[model samples]
Structure formats: structure tokens, C-alpha cells
Target: MQIFKKFSQLSIFYSEYVSFPYPHATTVKKAHKCTINHCLLHSHLVSSHASHKFVSSGGKPAGGEGDGAGAEMVGPQRPQFVLFGSSIVQLSYANGGWGAILSDVYARKADIVLRGYYGWNSRRAVQVLHQVFPKDAATQPSLVIVYFGGNDSMGPHSSGLGPHVPLPEYIEHMRSIAVHLQSLSDTTRVIFLSCPPVNEAKVREGVSGIFSELVRTNELCRQYSEACIELCQEVGVKVVDLWTAFQKRDDWLTACFTDGVHLSAEGSEIVVEEILKVLKGAEWEPSLHWKSMLTEFGDDSPYDLVAFDGKTTLNPSDWTFHRAIQWD
Candidate 1:
């Protein structure tokens, strides 16, 4: 059985650079440089090598192929969750990004693969699908979340534009992505996230540079987001309709987005909530509690016991249990 944590859209709010063809030293170094927190980069590094038998949940190479390995029985293959799309996906690992929050919550249970490229649209995403996700079973992810349309939905007239993908082409690209993912593994799932609604007032008033002119309007975003929902429905894929969900709340402009386009902390929280709902629908069981791992507990219980080294014994009673759950 695999444990998968919900992927957060918040990781896309900030900008970061990741080199092509993973497991490269230079890629990790550049990631560390762009990230606000080094810990996030470290977490990513650990996730990258998660497929190996020796890699531990902590991201370090532990155990070996030879003697005295009895105590080090291989752990269940950890689930991998991939984030694919534009800068929003890249920035999702930022301090307040959704990807960072997801990494914290799903820490030991799963690995969050960051494949977001800044300024990329559905067209560009299609070109790198094989590189990001291979046909190999070991590299297959439990869930692949595609977050696009922000750039694709940009008004055709916007000046100094980004790689604008037309709506019909965008829909086909999304469908193609789903088809390709299905080809990879039958068990793996795909979730399509609708483009977020942009606040034209905020962009015009506060946002600077090419982004100010290039950002799409709320109306245009709605069109694209609606199309995403339809495509997902037609293709039998799950969808997180952020465009509709965000506007349902009053003053969502200030509540959800940092600028007119990016997400604020509160906005990221909303995205997580929506994603969790989709996970629940897919019947993802929540993680076990600390108290359930106590020595006094019975083996008949459904929950997993606290994992520890065979060389060291842990007293569950010694641990402090808290009900408060916080994600930042």
C-alpha cells in the first residue's frame, strides 16, 4: 500500500529554476539558490532518490545489500506526487507556497516531485512530459497534478506576452497529458487544477513589469478554467476548480492572492483544502496517530506503529501528543 499526501498549488506562487534531466548536481544547487528555505531544497533532494532501496524517508542513504540487513527490512515503496505546470508550480515551494505546506504534511509518507517551469504553458509542458515522467514503473507517481491556464489564458492582446496557448489547443494539450499519464500506469491518478482568477485592479494598480500587461483578466480565466473542468469531466479525471472556489468567498482578491496573480498564505490554505477534498473523494486514508503507535497497542489495530530503527527502542509514552494541526 502507498501513502500519498495531497499536492498543494501554493508552490507555484514564487519563481525558481530547475535544470532538465533530474539527479544532476547543478539542478539541486540552482534550486537551493532560488528557494527561500534551504530545508525545502533538502527535502526535494531526499525525494529525488526515494526510489532506491537504500534511501530512507529522511532522504539519507541507509542500510545496504549485505549482511546484518535483517533489521533493515525494506520499507514499502513510498508514494511520489508530482507538481507540473508553470512558475506557479515552481514557486509553490516558496515559503508560503502550497508545495511547501504539502511537503511538511506528507513528509515521511510520500515524496513531492517539483517539475514546475517558469513561463511555461501547456504547449511547453507537453514537450517535457517524458523527461519529467518516464514510462519506468519505479519513476511512476501515485498522483500527477497539472496546474496551468494562468499563462495559457492570457488575453491575446496583452503586451510583452508569455507563451500564450490558445484555449482549444490548451484543452487538447490537457487531454493529451491525461492520456499520456494513463498510458504510464492504470493505478496512477491525475488531477487538473483550474487557472486562478486574476484581479485586474490589483495588477494594474500594484503589479509591475511585463506581468502587469501579460496577466489575464478574471473573465478570461473563467473561460479557461471552465474549459479545464469540462475536459477533466470528459476524460474521467478529477478537477480542482480554483477559479470558481476562490470567487465564492468575499474579497477573495485580497484573501487568496498576494498580487493580482500569485497566491497569499490564506489563498494557499484554500488550495490545500480543495485538494484534500479531492483526495478524500479518491478514498485516501489519513495518516496514523502517535498514540496508536504505543507499545501497549494491539496489532489488530488498522493504524501503523511509529517507525524506528531496530537497534533503538522508542517509548511512545515519551512523546508529546498534540491535536493542533498547522500548515504554513
Candidate 2:
């Protein structure tokens, strides 16, 4: 009952923020709006521990239906999938951005478990995975989605340029992940999303010398995508080329991203739609119940909360506090 009350409060808070306009038109202003939205969403889920219930309740709500049913449902329940990677997945909570969209679209189709960290590199990600998901002989996921490598390529390398790890080394790190996931379960499908492109102009203008480094990083992303495809084929892992999808659709750039680095709510939706396409093509059965939940709860996506007011001054106080717990 407390959880339900908390959930109701969450719904109310999200509704308020979703309806509020950004106080300003600058990137920081928009980010502040998104940050408030995210904090509220995450507070609801994490504070009330609803996500844990969702994970451990055997595909049933805590006190929902099926209590009096004599016979178990005949059809298969929702499939459980895990998402592991970087800021993209982490950013989903604020606006249900891409992850929320994917969850809504695929909810009754698949139960997605998201494990993402902001500013995490492949090396750190690998460590996090081990800590979070100590592979068990019996408990393995049906699908694993990995979206990383952007930070690794843009780092504080001694040269202050190029990939933190060379292309070959990056490929090996990815390979290790794939192999480990496979070892967990024969049926576990792994889908690795390619990192999207950075805006050259934004980079050059925003951070001096970072633009050239980002260009090189984007190039590596291209190369890495190609290599990942080959590596997956060789090792029998599924791959989703988000970079190519972004390239084909200009709207992915114009609609989704606030800056070259991060995706707006609209942009995240595009990414989710593209990912759904891949899942459907693979004939994966997503969870309809979860999809319904998303549709019901995520109808007011961040895109709908766009600010049109012409305020120019960006105010930091409007956003929720963000202390980067870890970096690099």
C-alpha cells in the first residue's frame, strides 16, 4: 500500500514537471528541465523499490490479478532482457527518453532490465557488469543490450586525442563481453548498439581541441561498428547498428539531440523505434504487459513537454542536483 501511494505520488510529480515549460531556451535550460524530470522519475522507481518488485515478482504485480486463478496461464509470460552500457540508457529515466519509448513499445513484448552508468568506459562497464550480474549457471537473461564506447574513444588519454583504447583493444573488450554473456546461457541473445555520431561544429565550438578528438572518435565508432559486425558474426552474437540507422534518418539528428553529445526525449524515441525494428526482425517476443504499462504511464513523453517560451537566460536552480558520483 505504501508502494502504491508512492507510485501515485510519482505519477503526480511527473505530470507536474511534464506540463511545466523550460524557463529558458538554452541547452542548460533544457537540460535542467530534463534533469528535474529524470530525478522525479528515478526517485519514484528507486525510492519505492518498484523496479525490484518488477524484477522479482515472477512477472506479476505485487497485489494485482491472478490471486484466485485455479490454473496458471497457458501462454508464455514476458521475456526478461537486460540493458548494459553508458549514459544513453541512464538518460532514459528522465523522459522515458529512448529506453522509456522502447519499454512502452515492447512492454508486453519484453521485460527490460536496464543497468547503465553515466561516463562509464568499457573497462569500467565490464567491472560493473561483474558486480551487478555475477553470472550464474541457471539465472541468465534472454537478451542483453550493450551501448558503450563513446566515452572510451573521447577520453583523458595521455595524448588527449583518439580512442582511450586502440581499435583492436576496444574490439577485444567487446568480444570478452559477448563471450561472457554467451557462456552464461546458450539461448541468451546479445544486441550491441553502435554509438551515434557527434556534431563536429558543436564540438569545435564548445570545447577547444575536443572537436578534433571527437571527429577521430566518431571515425573509430564507424570502424568499430564494422568490426563489431564481423566479430558478432564470427562469435554468433546479434548486433544493432544505431550509427547506420542515425545516418539514414536525418531526423534522428535534428529531432532527438539537444546537443551533439546527448539525445533529447524526441531523439531517444527515434533510437528506441530503431531498436524495436531490430528486435522484431529477430522475431523476439516482447512483453505486452510492460508495453501496456509504458503506454499508460509514458504517454506524456519529454517531447510533449517542449518549451517554446523565448526566455534567453539559462538558470541552473531549476534543475535537480547532479553530483557526478564517478567519472572517466
Candidate 3:
């Protein structure tokens, strides 16, 4: 299917394969030092409609189906969940990146739509909120995991040019985003990830290589994180307190972050745990947990291992991923 035109305009590079050139580094520390692989392969170049022809409820082809053409109720639509935020979200598919982890867990449960922009902050996020979560969406995302404020909480560069959004404005922007996402659909749910703490030493060590004149301090990040938590509590939105969670781990300072800011694989694991905890504990109806969700398509009944008896007795084995047959 053709991607929404507006969404196409926003995303220049869609999806890609990730492979690192670590040269068989032996130590975990050496692997951590390896640069993040960016061998991006654009997966959206091919049109989804090239193979299948979807017709509207009116029996017309999908392109110009016009009104009331809600596919499935109008072609088949898969359940969708969105991950929207800044670099933390954009680079999620990286090796062991948190977004990649969620994609793996929810592989057959739901489609994970990634909407991340590198170096973007709450200020910029608010400006493009509509395009990301359009009002005319045929089906809204069941869940949206939001991450921002890391850049927003930065100590402004001396040149006065950066993604630093004032704390009060940041809070308001986040609140607005939450409201807009919640308003998208009654089924839409939002989870905010508070900004995580940064290692001041590492930020000074390597951040300049990425963004000269960039400044970040744990103190600043903590304040922003506190603000996000407070905002989530006030608005009755679910949140993953990344700042506190990272701190709770004894090795977070050295283990959780790759360059004092971005998440390391270890850090991403923490994110996965936190997000799963929220999904399992939230009071949302019709839970979206991978274990709880029914896999798409029916069971692999045809592949079930049958007994080699001459008689046609039905003896299925679990080796073929066939759950116990319910005798209704």
C-alpha cells in the first residue's frame, strides 16, 4: 500500500538492515566501543500493493475508494502500535535498541510503526504532531510509547543554538502531545518515557564529536525527568521513569548508555523490561501483551507432527508450535 503522502514527506529514510563491523571483538567492553552500524536498507522502496489488489467496500480499487472505505471493515487491516519520539526512538531498530526489542516481542501480535526524528525535541515534536497522528487515520494505534526531553533538557550551547526547550514549555508540549494522541481514538493509549540521566563525563568526552558545543548534565536531565513524571501523574497518563530506573541499577553509569546519552544494548534491555512492566500492569482492556495476544493467522495445524500409525489418529506434538487444542 502507498504510505500516507504526508508521512512519506516526513520520513526520507524508512527502514534498513543493521550489521556491525566489530571485527570479532572479544570483550563486551570492546563491543560497546564499536560504532553503531548504519548500513540502512530502505525497505519501503517497493510498494505493498504491487502483489495484492485491495478493493474498497464499494468494490473499487484501494487508491480512490473515497469515504467509508475503512479497509478490513472496508480490506484487512492489522492492529498497529506506534513508537513516536526523537533519536532515542528513531534509532530504536539498532542492534539491541529498545525499539528493536519491542518489535521482536510483538512480531506477530501487532505492527510497530516507528516515528522517530534524530535530534528532535518536544518543541519540534509538537509542531508535527498532527502529521504523525492524523485525524483521518482509518485505525488508530493501540499504544504509543513516547520518548523526548533528553535533548530538550540539554544545557544550551554557548552559541545559543540547540534543541533545548525550556522546562515549562517542554512540560506543556508533552502534555499537548499526550492529549492529542489520546484524542486520536478511544482505543489509543499513551505511555511517556521520561528523559534518562546522562553521564556528564562521557557527554563531555564524545558528545562534542557529534554536536560541537553540545552540553548535557545529569542535574539538567533529572529536572526534566521529574517534570515529565509530574506531568504524567497530573494528566493520568502511564509513564516509564527512565531517569530513576537507570539510576536504580548499580552499573547504569557505565552500562546503560553508549555515549552518555544514547542507550547501550544493556540500557535497551532495561527499557524493554520497563515497557513490558507497564503493558502487563496497565488497566487497559483487551491487553496487548505478546504472550496474551493471539498470533496472526491460525495455528500451524498443517505442520503439526502426527503419529506415524497406520490408523488416522490425531496425535499432535508441540514441536510445531501448536498450542493445546481447545475442545469447545
**Each model's TM-score, in the order given?**
0.65, 0.59, 0.70
The true-versus-predicted C-alpha distance at residue 301 of model 2, in Å, is 30
lDDT of 1 by residue, 1-328 (tens): 1111233222312224443222211232223232333223222222322233322233322353342233322145566788888887888887478887776555545677898898788988888888777887575777888898898888664564567788999999999899998788766788889988878888777746644445568888889999999999999888999988888899897887777788887787778778767875664333122221122221111122222221211112221111113321
User: Cα deviation of 279 in candidate 1 (Å)?
Assistant: 0.5
Q: Model 3, range 170-200, lDDT digits (tens) per residue?
A: 9999999999998998888899999889888
- Give all candidate RMSDs, comma-separated: 14.0, 14.7, 14.8
- Itemize residue pairs with steric clashes in candidate 3: 1-48, 1-49, 16-41, 72-75
Please report, as a residue range, the 10-residue window in candidate 2 with the lowest summed lDDT: 319-328
Winning model by TM-score: 3
Clash count for each candidate, listed in order shown: 11, 15, 4
- Model 1's TM-score against the true structure: 0.65
lDDT of 1: 0.64
Lowest summed lDDT across 10 adjacent residues in model 3 is found at 319-328
